[model samples]
Target: MAKGWTFQSLIDEQMAVTAHCQTAPCHHRQVLDLVKLRDRFGPDAPAMEWDFKSKLKCSRCGGNKVGLIYTPDTSPTGYGKAKGG
Candidate 1:
């Protein structure tokens, strides 16, 4: 597992976090609010650490097998590249 990436890091980089349910028959996914998560877990909490998975639960299926996905926000106000260069 990589280290040094934290909730603050995600927020600073405008990364969108998503929670995905890995349990059988569920496979639910939801975009996470980085501010709320930073508040709950503190700004320094490990963002890419697998051990943090134990702290997550699926709201839809009520399962503990949760995984996190990090995506760079690509909206007009985000860090996406200009089109048709």
Candidate 2:
């Protein structure tokens, strides 16, 4: 696999998180789980995003708002901690 490529475990995690969500009357916990999983797995898992929107709908309640919050692109700044005030 290429660098940054998503593994099957990420997909499995998404599935487990969304299984119950597939049914109506979804729960919020499931959505949170999905967000966490996606964050842990990163934006490389295709299984997580394969719907009409070509995106991974939130696992909690199937809402698109449920996504991993992204931090600013700091790779160019080097892998160092920020300076203290």
Candidate 3:
């Protein structure tokens, strides 16, 4: 919707999101509410300062290299939409 959604913006919006493992040969990912990120690192911690890669650990292989992504609207269950449509 905007020019480009920054990792900071996503965190600020508290949108449901996913983090993918960036480690080679390990394509692990997880979707969770952005609030968790804020909660874990504190609201003042912007995306740049949060160092999300450092904060997250891949449950499958314990990889630290991670990338944040916006969760796509592919849910079959109609709750209208998340945050706002």
Best by lDDT: 1
Off by over 4 Å in 3: 1-14, 48-50, 71-85
lDDT of 1 by residue, 8-75 (tens): 99899888888999998999998888898889989988877484778889999899989888778767
lDDT values for all models: 0.83, 0.40, 0.63
Better of 2 and 3 by TM-score: 3
User: Runs in model 1 with CA error above 4 Å?
Assistant: 1-3, 77-85
- Lowest summed lDDT across 10 adjacent residues in model 3 is found at 1-10
RMSD of 1: 4.5
What TM-score quantifies how close candidate 1 is to the native fold?
0.78
Task: RMSD for all candidates, in order, please.
Answer: 4.5, 10.5, 6.1
TM-score of each: 0.78, 0.21, 0.52
Decreasing lDDT order of the candidates: 1, 3, 2
Choose 1 or 3, whichever is better by TM-score: 1
Pairs that collide, model 3: none
Predicted structure 3: lDDT = 0.63
**Top-scoring candidate (TM-score):** 1
lDDT of 2 by residue, 1-85 (tens): 3323243454443333332223345533332244554575555554333221234464545665432331222333565776554
* Model 3 error, position 75 (Å): 7.6
